[model samples]
Target: MPESLKKEIGQFNVFYIDYDNHDKGYCQSYRRRGFYKISLLEGETKLFYADKTMTFKRYALLFSNPNIPYSWELTGNNHTSFFCVFTEEFIRQFGMIKTYAVFKPGSYPLFELSEEQFRAFKDIFLAMQREIASDFLYKYDVLRTKVLDLIHAALRLQPVGKLPNKEANSALRITSLFTELLERQFPIESTLQQMELRRPAEFANHLSIHVNHLNHSLKEVTGRTTSQLIADRIIREARSLLQHTEWNIAEVAWCLGFEEASNFITFFKGREKLSPKSYRNSKIE
Candidate 1:
């Protein structure tokens, strides 16, 4: 990781990666416990996670909730880049409207940007960088506005595909809320020995509903069982840690809440058709 590029300011921070002074050796990936990133840039680059290549006309919004590991490569031409990093708390404090529908899990990772829209976003980042550097009063508050403006602009520009109608069923809404809550609890750290409610019975009990009812509601909407969804998330986290971090297999296994290293290996192999180490190695290739 680039030492200077890695920044932490209280709870929220933003950084700009200028192609001019930046070096390929300094190009590195980072994994944090809880954060989301939006990348605004120009020129061609390959985003590794979604296995997609993007140009200056394309913008990338990555909704990572501390569990998913992500990285990028600027292979083609040099271009300016800006990344805004913030936690849930930072976003909530800004008082921006929450359109969870746009950022929900499994959403598409890229959006094409119009020239005018790109210019507008570029201005926002420029202002944000200025705010970060200025010694003016209430700078944080001003920065907050810029952040909210960027989010609002993206929501307005991007098409959020058909979301589950909230008016349909109250039970489904509650179930959806419960599922979102469950997802938030994940990318669970390995040191947490006792499971913090992983099973369907546990979730149902927490939600004050029967296990069958929880299962039924989740299946109705997501087309997957609760356990399956949780397992999939775990696998995603495992892949991220294996690919992005220097942590070893046993450590990675423990971090994902697996009791034994062997069990983690078996589970990962079953899902990915490769061991963690093998998968990590493949990513670099």
Candidate 2:
């Protein structure tokens, strides 16, 4: 397959590409490090990411962090598009306050644009290009403003799905905080430590809440007990490491707080119906 849209690092490692060349099997196949892209074209294409394939239409916005792998397949060649790329630090220094929050790990990041909104975005890109070419002193600032303007416009036009109700939202907020904490201490290495951290009573004590109340809140909001959620998160992390890294079963188990490899094997088989190696090989094929 011809690699049409090769990667190029722009300002602060942001990737930029303008695909004009066409080959029979040309497609964009690569990953970005904290990248956001807005497509300004009327052409239809398929975007594959996060294990889902979706048809991308005119004026669509796609974003990915450093953690995800993504690729694109071009079905048609008649299109003109402009893209702006920048790193997380570049945006932090230049972007508005809430820009990072809007794209945080749990935040929904995809958006599709309306015709009018698309026109405005195209104008912003054009302006950015002109500014880049000139000897402007505050060109970076101009770019930052345009980027924020684009984000604000999208927020107004796009719906980030439904947030929970007020009470549910409050409960979910606590649950999210707890989940983040648990994930930070992941890959349980020893059963003793897992007991120390994964026990619902201990977690409730650390959060300064009664155990029963904590259980009730977490169950109501996430439909799972606190321990179940923790176990699931650990398993998910194990799967990621097994699939993406060349770690052996013993090492994987040790990293996840398992003292013995046998327990890890049993856990993997119980949840996945296959050993870690089998699952990994199946995915690659």
Candidate 3:
């Protein structure tokens, strides 16, 4: 067992991996208790992740945030890798880990690296090895910054998408991220998990931008205000739930964050021109 894996329970842990130790390495993924992991592998493997499945060869970067379940199945002979696991509390300065495209579900978190890029990343991991092993003061602080560098650099490498309008401008980019965050929350997989960030301000808070700024960016890029966008999504989700699931109207309302079933009914009627029950009944009929 690696020392870092057994090290004193704390907010931060870092180490290069030994592939044979499957329990302690990045080779397996599941819903972690609280920590987030970032890893780089040097060989081929099949990735089974919550949002998608993929296979990678040569060099790959893998990111695992809490609640985003993932696992790895080795396919090639070599499985050398380095990874670090740390809690959100470990780096007080950094938040919005979710906003990073790499950590978001349904986005490609694993990237095959070119030889040159692979060496560059390997260098970063090597530095992490040296830093964590050293007795230097403020080593954790230094390590945190290095990890941030690794994360942001990887994010910059993600191929640009059309929706974010990277070609348009900064505001448009922010708007795109906001839209994606909203979309990722649903089709509401089960009635058990309640929806969050159902309001514009919640999203603005998550994006670390002012609500007005978020609304302005969204309005400019989408021609719809932030509230409008959120409402549209909620209505879309509500419609899907009503039309498909056998859950009662109250249950559907609860999943979408409505406090009372009547409130859900009024909201649905105003938007869809039919009550939730009526809509569901229509679908059934």
Error of 1 at 74 (Å): 2.1
Off by over 4 Å in 2: 1-20, 24-41, 94-102, 159-285
lDDT of 2 by residue, 1-285 (tens): 122112112542222344555343334533453355544444556665433455656556655443333456656665455666665444665542323544433344456667776677778777878876666656666777777776777666653243435655556556655655674575444433342365687778888888887777677654568877767766777887787677778887777767899998898899889998898899789
Q: What would the TM-score be for candidate 2 when compared with the true structure?
A: 0.48
Give the clashing residue pairs of candidate 2, or none.
187-256, 187-257, 188-256, 188-257, 189-257
Per-residue lDDT value at 38 in model 1: 67
List model 1 lDDT by residue over 1-285, tens digit each: 333224235556778776867674223344564566667766555553322233333444433333323466665555667777776656665442224543443343455576777788888888988887877656667877887777667766654232344422544454556656665665444444334666788788878888887777666644567788678767877876787678878887877767699999999999999988899999989
TM-score of each: 0.52, 0.48, 0.51
CA RMSD of each candidate after superposition: 10.8, 11.0, 13.8
- Order of candidates by lDDT, top first? 3, 1, 2
Output the better candidate (1/2) by TM-score. Answer: 1
List per-prediction Cα lDDT, in the order shown.
0.62, 0.60, 0.74
* Cα RMSD of predicted structure 3: 13.8
Candidates sorted by TM-score, best first: 1, 3, 2
| Worst lDDT 10-window in candidate 2 | 1-10
- Measured on C-alpha atoms, candidate 3 has an lDDT of 0.74
